[model samples]
Target: MRLNKVVLMAGCAMAIGLGAVSARACEIKIGATGPMSGAATQWGLAIKGAADFVAAEVREAGGLKVGDETCQLKVVTIDAKYTAEGGAAAANNFVSQGVKFVLGPMGSPEVTGMKPITTRNKILMFSDSYARDAIGKRWPLTFHMGPGPAAWGDPIVKMAKEEFGIRKALTIAPNDQAGTDVAEVVAQVYENNGIPTKLEYYQRGTTNFAPIVTRIMAANPDVVDTVSTPPGDAGIIVKQLRQAGFKGAIGRLGGPGTEEITRIAGGLDVLKDFYWFEPVFIDDNVRALQKRYHELVGVEAPENNFFFLFVAGGRALAEAISNAGTYQDAEAVAQSLRELHVNDPNLGQGKWIGEKTYGIRQELSLPFGMGLIRNGETLPVRRSDAPTDE
Candidate 1:
């Protein structure tokens, strides 16, 4: 989890029921909701791919263990179209389908909208998105798989102190829950660390950022952490930053995690002057997955997103089901999940922490990629090399 550097291959298909299974006993009706046809559809599409892959892989391998039942995980994908209403509808459908376990609908509002449904039905919802006030209560069945935007903030500052000699920083985020949340967390840490922050927020989709740009530069912080979509939108902010001629050092919430942002910007080196967060590790197991994923999808996987995270999440569910030893009691899956633990063939060991209310804290191991943006690329600036707040 703390190491990087990769060269990997897919592993042999192993026995499903200890041999190799195409299908089997228990049927786990799990649902995944996402914006399959909206402006923010990229995330949903990636998650759909990830969930599908995980469901197939796990089911083929005999299914997960729950107490003593080897229940097969059956994933049902629902298109939310990036609307809270759609999410609500999707959650209702899942509940009707008797899906006691569920994944996500891309970002924040979806997670917030589905809460009533998940909570009412006692369905456990796991999201690749950050935590919000609606999900504020740690329900017995909801868990946030990814860290809040703030996840990378502390480490970015830590690295700044050690590497950039930065005591002053400017912060930018779209004026939304995800954006503001990341800014708040970062600002808190910066203030706590005794570093002054030139914090600013803008409407996420606003066209002209000249004013914001001018304001940020005027404050003149040593570095900037532009928090926005891990991909698409964040690019706009960074592009504006460069155009405005303010280039000290920048940290992005998850900019490097998006291949398009990197490729379009020219190369990974564009992020060379910025700090970025990586959702999954490129360990041997993960690399093996990447190879197989590419082979199957014919498209190289994005570095982050629910694309791979869902597979890891599905596998985690499978392991829990395997440990449960039975599949009859849907509610009991959490207990079974708690009892089982394995090195996620994707994320890493000890990556998931048990939080019954929120299911599993899917990625307990946080490995953020701190890189510098240069020539329109992100190069390795440094790595946190530790979990949580390194």
Candidate 2:
């Protein structure tokens, strides 16, 4: 009886020890705030879904290595409804949850509102906006993941002049901060490239483009460029422009505007002389990833086309945490991020840039691709200059 009692106590102790060891593994939480409802739901869904997918992938691969133990990743997404108030609320919720890393609260208004909350809590936010106002000293903790307005507009204007023989351009946008910023950048680029540019602004949700298109046709510019127009509105513009008999070239200083434009225009045949500053490098490897993603999720990749950045950011954060030897120290993790030279098939090779502009080395400077819609497919035209991390 005594020998049996001893064995039972020993087994209980061993079980408790193993259970404690299992519980020691950390649960890392990543937060994402974006417009998950209303017109911009696609953007939010893409960012959130990509982050969740990457976390799942990491979880499947035996979790993230943090010091001597493995940590699991959990992506917590909140819908901001494309409003500043919504963004602030989401940021507060993340603060309460003790989340240090956040993916996005896209658009100028959403990001602007979320900035104070994120700064107060020392949370690292990755912004997707190309507006210059979104960065700088005010939002020190925030990093711009997407390319700047000039990055896209410069090439598009150059392409318009050299390839399409476009000498005159007219720009239209939503009149919001992002639209205004992008429009200004594109106009400047066009002017510099010897293409005289005119500007027009419209309120958001203005579906009726009859008046707008009529006015654009009156201008009779060689190119009609849409700067930072949302997907739904972009489609409306394209369809209406065709109906209004504007035979000038159509172009986008921002976004590929492929699937949305195609669906709304009824077919690719409607899009004549269209060009875009593509966000993603649509190479063979990225195509493979997109196929696999569709198989797992039952839909095509996000129209935003920068879903790979979230995945890369997640992996980079995990690596940073491991290298820093502490998950709680955000500054150390940020430093690690700056030091990382990321080379992914989806994003291609790039590293942190923008110390001269943003007052910090936070922006990921990667090779920006330019393309045109040819036969219902995006065909690359040129590759922008990017400093390779040697």
Candidate 3:
């Protein structure tokens, strides 16, 4: 009896030791990189917040299952500072830490910079950037979070033209790849809609837009488009344009930042007439995501609507990881992701597109919305169906 009791205790001790070892071995780290500072800070925060919320949700549901072992999901975030160099450094950091999956690097320049590192290291990435080459056939492991201007620009431009009766338009942006790429696409859309357009660029860090505003006013454009300009810069440009006695409607065919722009430009009244692209249509279902995020993360989600998009993307990544049965094999996980049906409880159904523009069908096309502020009164966001390769 004494020998039997001793043997039982030894078995229990061994079981507990193996359990601890298994727990440590099954930790999966996901890397989230974006511009966590400067004017684009809100965009970056959305990426981090989405990853954090997804990690928490997985933990609350008894952890993520990868094959036989239940794995704990951990998010490791880095601020790419909205720059090319920053993005490359972040990718190197992730590789050194053995992180095989990545979530962001939101700006065009950052995506361009990070692609080489991620591709070389066989890391899979889901990125949000308006650059033309944000995702392509060369980088099979890279995916786009949503459609860029090339997908949704036409309808929004046509709506603006019909509603406001704008004649000629001018697009202003920073003189960088992030700006030029989106600006050219938006400008082409405006011109396609029979509205002649001109392109203007300013140094990225230019705080005062007085000179640029003067140049814009010289053309006497009936509408001015702030394509791909950072929200902070857009607000200043809008305020200066209004102050200079320009009564034309303002357009933003770039990323969503209406909240930040309104606050910086004083108020909606100051904006007068404005039209911009909203990434997600804020219906009750979408609003419910905020509640879930708060419940799991213990804080309010970032105000940027990009947060919702990232949440959808993050959940999809988790599913792919589980399906592939290993986070270490990025190619296998990428294959799993490509086979996903693109459905989300909150965001509803979506599809993978982009063969025509990017020469690859890796872009996630989800329903989007357009915001309008006429005579200082904000209207309901108008929903648009997901785009196709056509």
Query: Which stretches in model 1 have alpha-carbon errors above 4 Å?
Result: 1-26, 35-40, 62-71, 81-83, 132-138, 149-152, 254-258, 263-272, 295-306, 325-328, 351-390
On TM-score, the leading prediction is 3
Error of 1 at 285 (Å): 3.5
- Candidates arranged by lDDT, highest first: 3, 2, 1
Residue-by-residue lDDT tens digits, candidate 2, 1-390: 011111111111123643653244467889977888765666777788677766665655556666655667778999877767788989999989989888887777788778898988888888777677767777777887766656556666776677678989999988877688778887888888888999988987787988988898899998888867877788889889988887777888866556777688767778766788766656676667677676655677665665765656665666666676666777777777777767754667776766655566677766666777644455565667543222
Ranking by TM-score: 3, 2, 1
The candidate with the higher TM-score, 1 or 3, is 3
| Model 3 misplacement above 4 A | 1-25
Better model by lDDT: candidate 1 vs candidate 2: 2
Quote each prediction's TM-score: 0.78, 0.88, 0.94
Q: Show the lowest summed lDDT stretch of 10 residues, model 1.
A: 1-10
lDDT of each: 0.60, 0.72, 0.88
Task: Write candidate 1's Cα lDDT for 129-172 as tens digits.
Answer: 55445244455556555455454556656766665677887778
lDDT of 1: 0.60
Residue-pair clashes, model 2? 0
